[model samples]
Target: MEATSSGRRSKQIRAKKRIEQLKAFYIHLAVFIIVNIIVIAGAVSGNMNNGQSFGEAFFNFNTFSTFIFWGIGVLFHGFKVFSYNPFFSKAWEERQIQKYMDADRDEMKKYS
Candidate 1:
């Protein structure tokens, strides 16, 4: 009975945490998407389209930078170059979990 209850509690806790983490992840992703749209729109509005070459356009040193190109390119990558996680990365997942846990503390305290 004791073991069963402990397992159940653990499962519940894990589920709650997972749900919170997903919420946080979605919130971050939504904001990122919105920001990306705005940035792209601004660039387009300013007639910031393609350059002389694809390389020059992507690695715009006189503008954003090649570093930015790599940064965005590898936003969801690690270990291998081609095979990589993009949206919800391991580091990103942990960060979002922490963010969610922090946000839920007050609500948790109320229950406690």
Candidate 2:
């Protein structure tokens, strides 16, 4: 049937979109890790050259700040990729649709 084929196509499209999202998330994670490692390494080396101890250099705020900030972005990206919206879920969408439909019915009743 046409409806069955359309449903299958819709599912395929959604699956493809999900795969793309996952791929993008992985790329983002890789970049985050690689860049943070470079930044932290530079910070540590610079600090040690300035006479700081290894532990002090490695654990400095400046050394880890990039990781912390970029990690926040990666966390948000993960949430988006994983479809982790708590507020605007399917139930919320259905409720909003029903609410609007009820409002429209009430307005039509007043006109009739």
Candidate 3:
């Protein structure tokens, strides 16, 4: 009974931590959107003040550079929060470990 209770507590703690990570990632995304909007608006206005047309100012790379760069960081953060590793997952690692162990066993049988 105590072991089950402890296991449940451990799982609860891990879940709480995961929830916190998700919340932090969401906050980061919100801040990224808010800040980028302000930055883009400022850049557009600055460019227009400098005599560029509204369309040119709005479409300029400088106007969205911060959004693009910071968005990359936000995307990475989201991926990390969600455990989205394309190249290496827990199942993949386990399969690789099993494959190596089987190969070693086969090699040992040949030696025997």
| Best of the candidates, TM-score | 3
List, residue by residue over 1-112, the lDDT tens digit for candidate 2: 9999999999999999999999999999999999888999999999999999999999898899999998999998998898787879988999999999999999999999
> Per-prediction RMSD in angstroms?
13.0, 1.8, 2.1
Worst lDDT window (10 residues) for model 2?
82-91
> Which portions of model 2 show Cα errors greater than 4 Å?
none
Clashing pairs in 1: none
Q: For model 3, which pairs clash?
A: none
Candidate 3: global Cα-lDDT? 0.95
Candidates 2 and 3: which is better by lDDT? 3
Residues 32-103, candidate 3: write the lDDT tens digits. Answer: 989998999999999999999999999998899999999999998988999998889889999999999999
List candidate 3 stretches off by more than 4 Å. Answer: 103-112
What is the overall TM-score of model 1 with all chains considered together? 0.44
Provide the lDDT at 88 for model 3.
Answer: 92
